[model samples]
Target: MAGYEYVSPEQLAGFDKYKYSAVDTNPLSLYIMHPFWNTIVKVFPTWLAPNLITFSGFLLVVFNFLLMAYFDPDFYASAPGHKHVPDWVWIVVGILNFIAYTLDGVDGKQARRTNSSTPLGELFDHGLDSWSCVYFVVTVYSIFGRGSTGVSVFVLYLLLWVVLFSFILSHWEKYNTGILFLPWGYDISQVTISFVYIVTAVVGVEAWYEPFLFNFLYRDLFTTMIIAWILWSPSDILEIHPRVFYFMVGTAFANITCQLIVCQMSSTRCPTLNWLLVPLFLVVLAVNSGIASSIENGLLYTLAAAFTVAHVHYGVRVVKQLSNHFQIYPFSLKKPNSD
Candidate 1:
């Protein structure tokens, strides 16, 4: 098995094998988007590599970032005012983001259908997704205007950190329990982002800056809703179904607390292969916070470019290492083992 840590084929085939599989609790994805993605998956040629599909979708997001940079070079500026980029730019980015979201769903199906599924595929897909989450938030900040004060910057940083934490928590859950449970929040976020795009297209990006109810900015209201969901959903107060609330709120707290305890009790038992990588995110959070507060356009672009290159490099290294250890050529457009 080429030094690979292999699980037994019988174990893989058992009824509980995929019990922890990535479960999407989103109604829109379950009822509407998945069928559409299945159809799209069917259209892809068998010879087309699934990893390529995944990477291409991520590239579209990168293109979205570039488009923002090109259209509004002052987007990251420390200046207090918002950029006057055309309304169509927001519309274009919105459409591109939706396409990226759709393709993100399609890649896994393409992998399974073509028999090319591998751990590498899962890692690659998710690793890119982790980075894309940050990109999406940064884009939103640019549109709404970067926060100039320390408090505002902290709020933005905290929002970004929580989103990333939720993602990291999922991986930690899988590491501990061997199941990947996708929360309802993920689905709701996708739909909300899509809705944001449509709204931006209709009303223009400037509308987000206007005061809504009680003199709060529309963007502030949206942020408040997200923050409220993060804090309040775990309680028994919401009208959500019990099982769903448990899945969303209870699971998140458990994953976080469990991982923290593990890390505290035994260094070797940490769920992640690279524990240092986790802290690097905090460093990024701080750096980005400073950049947002100072409105340093040059540092912002430099950091973005650096992160893109470094992330891709790290992703390739992970895939290569996993491929070597598992003896599975994930880059090959071939079918995976049935077992």
Candidate 2:
């Protein structure tokens, strides 16, 4: 009943009992991630509305795609022998991807704090994400394929998967039955471990046997981490699934270990961690432009075929009401009739 409150615990399936356990969240990111900048976003006042954050994310994604296309791999080069095209193009593409992901993290925070967490906001957030995936895969694979039949298959299938997910997610939200590891509590260790792994992947120093990041952070791998632990949390509810329960536990442990690692690995030596993601440029780039070979092309074709089938099946299930997703959040939105 206080400050634009909406329905909480809007039950979809059995996720009504979603609890705030140790594994699913971290406390810090829940708050700090919101756009509380000191007069930085000039056009709109900081407090105008958090809705702009959502728009900002979309713009960034578009910018990234455009940058990639303009710098087409046919024109850009990365490393000495790894030459592709224009070096600045790749650099800009990577930087833009980094910016998009970072913005992805901020919008939610701004929404909740500003009490602007509307049904439209949720829809826009998820919709943009799906589109971003679409644009990214299509643009990159198309070029990486260099007009090969194999590349066509992979791009086609990967896109089918994103489309299916987006459709189902919208319905899931409409019915208020999204899968629940829990609700909007930010899990600290889960994110920290992800960042650590990404960092490890970038450093050219030494590649560990099992991807040192993974071996070093078993908790992140095992934990069923989500954005469920940062905000309103309690310890009373029992988990409906054993596997999910354990994942949460592992995430908690991993979060603790990551904090320690940050302390041990920082240049300032103050145990602080930075969350921006320019370092992931190569990974996304890889997804965009895979290497060309007969075997690689064959695999792309197969993946495309399988995903297409999966997309068809998901549509069938939704149409027949054979699916019943359990939603963890108790909040409800008045889904607008699109018809």
Candidate 3:
């Protein structure tokens, strides 16, 4: 509450609202999912805070994470090279993840309907999304058969790093261009994760690790696809449009390298609070790589906890900065004053 500004009920009706523009390219999300979420949004009560929806969705992911930690055989040394995760767990995780995915869209619509849209909402949504990306990937890795090995863990960390980089780059683009340019790969990745969960439930984890034929395993094929996507994704975006390329790939890479430079030089004028982004990301990668090499489940959970705490601190700082810049309360739930 120290960083939060309060608005009286009498002054709640006149605050300006920010427009939301997410450039989604997945055909299902654009044509079907958005409409479904909008319909769900219409039924949400006026007083329901958008931040609550965002937080709830994130909590669901957290729950699934806990479940994985407790039940995943690959997560601990007690069951070395043993995988007995129940089919029901995969089903539950898949349903929860999909619901979370749906709620991610719903929260923005709820904010607009209630006239509570704010930069805090955008930051909160993306912040949770960044963590969710790691959680989902880790969940898959726990069951990935070859995931416990050194090389496999490195590959997993690389994948997660790219995912996080893409998420942060989108925010940097918004800061520079004032548009939330969602990439097509984001939608594809979400759908792929959801599908992986479903497939795991149907076929079980062994199928994923078993050799298909002539020593080629499903995991090998999946890894190849991931690497191929990383290489080809830019060209694919370039084919779609140059502007999309500029925002998604061009600025993304630029931010990865030069964002800290800009932040340092412009801190007096811009005051970017999340200056630790790159450093913390590197720490996470290093820590996870060590854990992977040691196959230490305890260290993995510790890393997760550390990442969560760091991000929460960073998020609060960002919200405070945005609140001051905009002269509005952070995470306010009430309708703005109309007078």
Q: For candidate 3, lDDT tens digit of each residue in 175-229?
A: 5665667887866666677777778889866555532212222232223433343
Candidate 1 structure quality by residue, lDDT tens digits, 1-339: 233322223322331223226667778789888988988888888888888888888898878767766765434332256445666776788788888888898999988898767655766677667667666665554555444421233344455556656776676676666666787787677667766766776775555553212222223322343334334333211222211221222222323333332232222244433332333344334444453334333333443354444444545554665565456666666435534
- What's model 3's overall lDDT? 0.55
Model 1 poorest ten-residue lDDT run: 236-245
Q: Clashing pairs in model 1?
A: 20-179, 20-180, 78-295, 115-335, 115-336
Off by over 4 Å in 1: 1-20, 73-83, 147-151, 209-268, 271-311, 326-329, 334-339
lDDT of each: 0.55, 0.34, 0.55
In candidate 1 the C-alpha lDDT for residue 293 amounts to: 31
The root-mean-square deviation over C-alpha atoms between each candidate and the true structure, in angstroms, is 11.5, 18.4, 11.5
Minimum summed lDDT over a 10-residue window in model 2 is located at: 208-217
Q: State every prediction's TM-score relative to the real structure.
A: 0.63, 0.37, 0.63
CA lDDT for candidate 2: 0.34
